[model samples]
Target: MLAALHLIFPPRCIGCGGAVTDDFGLCAACWRETDFISGLVCDKCGVPLPGKNEGRAELCDECLTIARPWDRGRAAILYRDTGRRLVLALKHGDRLDLVPPLGAWLARAAEPILLPDMLVAPVPLHRWRLLKRRYNQAALLSGALARAAGLDHCPDLLARPRPTPSQEGRGREARFANMADAIQVARRRQGQIMGRPVLIVDDVMTSGATLAAAADACLAAGAASVSVAVLARVAKEG
Candidate 1:
């Protein structure tokens, strides 16, 4: 029966649409193609680098220059070619099945550093953006991570108070300025999130502005701490 089903509806790779078995939704070739970030990573933000000694440096140059509101952050992959495509597909392509594997990756990457009392919340998109996109990618990712980690995932707690310019092609400082004050913790859910450690989830982290702004809002609302988990991180240079 299963064989007949496969014949009727052949399984295709999520990454490259090639034939594959039922594992991670990616064919072997596509899986091998992914440049998973490993090796030396920034202590405050997980940006993997080469050289064993690099990890001992304590902080990345960028993070050293500026202090972020969030305690720290981590990511599973580097935001390059294949990583970019996978994130776009999961967000704009309506491939919700990718959530589980992506979520599991996030959980694994974050497990060692995660706070025991963390409550998960996705960085909210503005209502207009949400309407255009049809779904919140961060929320979906957060939900999956929460299930895997056994933490509280709250979708309605944080909201974009206003729409901001696209951070793409913007300078880091500009992006930070653009996102500051763009988010607000929902008054109704404020009680539920306050006094709890919060982990903000996002599909990607580029300038670190979005997460920082979100963390600021969470802290302002009385959250004890705010950390971040992203599926991918844009390279420091771009």
Candidate 2:
């Protein structure tokens, strides 16, 4: 039945809408266009390193100057062109079909950072936003990631109790302020929260404020550690 369905609607390249070998498979041209993040990167944030390595787990200039609450982060791709398009499609284009490939990418990106028995969760959506969107994309991504990474997932474990203004165009300070007190660990999950490392999943990470707020809440709830994984990361401007 599945093969028959595939015959009826054969898989096509996500990047170019051209025919591909299998579902979520990129054609040669699309494959070349995809920018996977790799090589030396900032030890903490996972931003790709430029010229040469400074040291193992070398901190980027931003990391040197500013501190992040999460102990580590990983992103599958730099947010641009193909990568950005994939994320936006999943976030707003109702591309539910993209979840599996994106989730797999996230799992691979997180392979080095994933820890045993760590609780996994999506950065929460405000009720109003959730209502409008009709689905929490992050929850879907986190669910797939938790399964692939062998971690326990509880989508309701973290939440946004209220709506916050859009983060776009906000300065770093403004973004932090807007996200302050935004994420809460559920009271029922107190036992799960305490002493357990947690991983927050997201679609794209720009300023990192949202994940920081989520990590702050998790730590405040007595979580032993916090980290983040994302489908894409907005590259630092030079």
Candidate 3:
């Protein structure tokens, strides 16, 4: 039966609609174009650095200067090329089928910060945006990552009480200011976050303002600590 189904609809690459041996995978050509982050990275933001891993935590120039509320962070890929395409598809194109592969990537990236008792949550979308999008990409990624890591998932741990303008084209400080006080822990779910280590998941981290807001809310809710994971990280061009 499965073979017949495969014959009728062969598995295709997630990046491109080309036939592949399995589902939830990128073809070799697309895989080559994807910039998966590995080796030395900023301990706070997960941007790839220019050196070998020496068993030490290092911060990128931005992370060094910025005040990051989260204790640690990791990103599965650099936000460009195939990575960018995949993220946009999941976020705006409603490519829900991409969740499994993206979640696996997130789980691998987040391994460095995963704890046995960590509670996973997604940066919440504003009610209006959620209504329009019909789904929260971060929540989908977070749930899949939680399952992959065998951690507890709490989709409603955070809430966005009001909508904020899009952060696109905004400077770092501007973005941060715009996101201030925008997100908070939901009152009903406070017990799930209190005294627990929380990992906030997001689709992408550009200025990181959104993540900072979410992390702050976790800390304010008495979470023991906060960490972050994202499918992609936007790195500055040299």
| TM-score order of candidates, top first | 3, 2, 1
Order of candidate numbers by lDDT, starting with the best: 3, 2, 1
Per-residue CA lDDT of candidate 1, range 1-238, in tens? 8788888878878788788877457777777767676667776677875568432545677788988788878889888767778999998899887888888888887775678878999989899999999999999989888889898889878999888988889987799889978888999988988799999999998878899888998999999988898999888553
CA lDDT, every model vs. true structure: 0.84, 0.87, 0.95
Tell how far residue 136 is off in model 2, in angstroms.
1.3
- In candidate 2, how many clashes are counted? 0
With a 3 Å backbone cut-off (N, CA, C), the pairs that clash in candidate 1 are none
Q: Which stretches of candidate 1 lie over 4 Å from their true place?
A: 1-7, 53-57
* Backbone clashes, candidate 3: 0
Candidate with the larger TM-score of 1 and 2: 2
* Residue 60 in model 2: lDDT: 73
Weakest lDDT window of 10 consecutive positions for candidate 1 = 49-58
Clashing pairs in 3: none
